[model samples]
Target: MSRVVSRGLSAASGMLGGALAGAIFKQVWKLASGKEEAPQATSEEYGWREVLVAAAVQGAIFGMVKAAIDRSAAQSIHRATGK
Candidate 1:
């Protein structure tokens, strides 16, 4: 039962983490690149460098946020269940 509950919590937190990461990425991108929005790959105005850099930064932010959220959820479950 606890395992099921933990899995559910983890899934929910993963979604929340994604949303949080997106907002953070936007702000970081704006500050770093002076652009309100990151360039899309299909945008002819942006070259490969801009698109690739944005992708890398976004991926790093998302990965870190997901890891932090998952770790926190696991620790909470462990503390509650002693498992």
Candidate 2:
């Protein structure tokens, strides 16, 4: 496949992963804190403080996982090319 297609797939995968991570993290936090499980009305409703805190934690974890998968994929490509 072309590099453009590969990049697009990678991007879509990363975005999906990030969104899933964020949702799971938010729910887990709410559950652990004994808070209600209802979804917020808007991103702003959570406020920057809570949003940023959750975002940072979830983003870091998701970023690491995404990077690992990307790195492994690159390695496989390199190995296939005998590089």
Candidate 3:
């Protein structure tokens, strides 16, 4: 209920959400590409198009997860503090 506790909860939620998003992305990429490994933007083996696409997908997933987690945390904090 305190500010410290609320911030701590938000931080923890963000970490958990990021990890979940990464795992989800890996599974999604595997299914979509039929490959075990996702393309890396810095890797020399992958073409520019492949690398860019991978980066875009990864960014989108991370952004969505972060936003969702942040929103949920904010709502929960508001309910707890009535502020």
Candidate 4:
């Protein structure tokens, strides 16, 4: 069904976005805290392992946040619709 496919795609997109945000957030945190000594390099200089780990963390955070947001949004919409 198109609905099922759309749901799957939405989930995949959410995970990917979360992972990307997490990785960037991790890198930015490092840079901001002065933990990273060298200037930032391009993606070619960054390894996959670091990115994967960051993405995992980010995905988890995003998942939790997304759940809360969805719940609240659903509740608000339901109330508006008198459902």
Where model 3 places Cα greater than 4 Å from the true spot, the runs are none
lDDT of 2 at 69: 68
> What is each predicted model's overall lDDT from 0 to 1?
0.93, 0.68, 0.86, 0.61
**Weakest 10 consecutive residues of candidate 3 by summed lDDT:** 1-10
* Model 4 regions more than 4 Å off: 1-42
Instruction: Quote the positional error of residue 78 for candidate 1 in Å.
Output: 1.1
TM-scores of the candidates are 0.92, 0.52, 0.90, 0.44
Which segments of model 2 are wrong by more than 4 Å?
1-47
At residue 65, give the lDDT of candidate 3.
90
Ranking by TM-score: 1, 3, 2, 4
Residues 1-83, candidate 3: write the lDDT tens digits.
57788788877888899899999899988988888899876789989988788788989999999998888877887897798
Clashing residue pairs in candidate 4 (N, C-alpha, C atoms within 3 angstroms): none
| Candidates 1 and 4, the one with greater TM-score | 1
Task: Let me know the TM-score candidate 1 reaches against the reference structure.
Answer: 0.92
Q: Pick the candidate with the highest lDDT.
A: 1
Looking at candidate 1, the ten consecutive residues that score lowest on lDDT are 2-11
lDDT of 4 by residue, 1-83 (tens): 85696577568756766666566666765764455532243466657765565556556666776676567655875686676
lDDT of 1 at 47: 94
Clash pairs, candidate 2, are none
lDDT of 2: 0.68
Weakest lDDT window of 10 consecutive positions for candidate 2: 32-41
lDDT of 4: 0.61
